[model samples]
Target: MLSPGDTLSDFTLEGVDENGEINTFTLSELTDDAVAVLNVYVYDYSPVCTDQVCDISELEWLGINEDVNVVGISGDGPYSHQQFIEDNRIGYPLLCDTAEEIIEELGVLHEEKDGLRRVPQRSIFLIDSDRVVRWKWVAEDNWDEWDSGPIEALNDTISQIRA
Candidate 1:
């Protein structure tokens, strides 16, 4: 499992744009001068996931951090992600972790919840320009008591960390 100050492995995934066209997210690309907010979630249109994604744009202070690059990742394929983006008006790029390779590699896989397996645990990672994970949160369970989106808690932590 990754920890604070541990640099993450550079990984790329097939991403999708608002137009449903093929997009790509290479972690190395964002490490130059930005703190990337890795928004990892479950299915694309799942209720909690939908609310979380929709609420991201409301995080206006994201600009407070140096160049916030928000990327939403899930097991949903590119097509589904495209639809979700169009439906939810997600302003950020969404990566399709259909094979769960990245999820498993990061050890954030929420296994076998009610017979469903390979669900990407609702988690977030703040990868600063150094490519180091400066802050992270993995819900002990699903998003029930754990609000996994980029909430005030994360913003406060990031502000303090970067201050």
Candidate 2:
């Protein structure tokens, strides 16, 4: 798993922007001028995932933090991400990892019991403008109840980094 201080390489992926348009975006583009919070979730509309994204989207500090870019990544496609953004009023861009390449590379890929399905393990990575990871949190177990503390911690970390 990627840890704090590891440098993340730039990668391109299709993402649904805040305006609900699908576009190709590279990691460098998102992090070049700002710190980035990479929120990796299991699925778009899954109950916990929905709550997770919504919590991040509604963070008050995020509205004022132009220097922090929060981007979500999941195996769902662009159409799903667009609907998710519209349905939940998500303010951040959600990238599609349909190929699972990024998820696997980040060591967050989760496989199902049946061995037929794979998804991203719920995780978050904070990367600074230099592409070095400053913080990382990965779920210990996939089915654990959702916790809002991590999101708050992420916000606090962003503030500390920019301070």
Candidate 3:
């Protein structure tokens, strides 16, 4: 499993930005001298996942320091992500992992969602400019929903990193 201090894998993915624009996002964009928060949610429209995604955006205090790129990833396609973003007024990039490729690579696949196993477990990774994952969190139960804890912790971690 990819753990803290481990470099994230390189991958190009289609995602919906805050403006609902479709764009190609490469992991290297976050690695090339940028701090990032990579959030993996199960589905786009689900209640818990929605809360998890939006929570990261609503935390304005985190922006009191350096900018941290907040990117959300899910098995949902770009279209679905766009709608989700519009519906919730989200202001971040939400990436698609429809093939579960990145989810599998991250080692956070829920493993029991589809017959072939594609759903991603609710998780978060705090990766630094060097691509090293500084912090990691994965839900213990697939059914459990995420609160502000992850993003709040992310905010705190960002503060520490920029300090």
Off by over 4 Å in 2: none
- Top candidate on TM-score is 2
Q: Which pairs, if any, clash in model 3? A: none
Candidate 3 to truth, TM: 0.90
Clashes within 3 Å, all models in order: 0, 0, 0
RMSD of each: 2.3, 1.2, 1.9
Lowest-lDDT window of 10 residues in candidate 3? 59-68
The per-residue C-alpha lDDT of model 1 at residue 82 equals 79
For candidate 1, lDDT tens digit of each residue in 1-42?
777888888889999855667878898886667778888888
Q: List the residue pairs that clash in candidate 1.
A: none
Give the per-residue lDDT of model 2 (tens digit) for 66-139. 88888999999999999999999999999998999988888899787778988789999998888888988898
> After aligning candidate 1 to the native by TM-score, how far in Å is the CA of 74 from where it should be?
0.6
Comparing 1 with 3 on lDDT, the higher-scoring candidate is 3
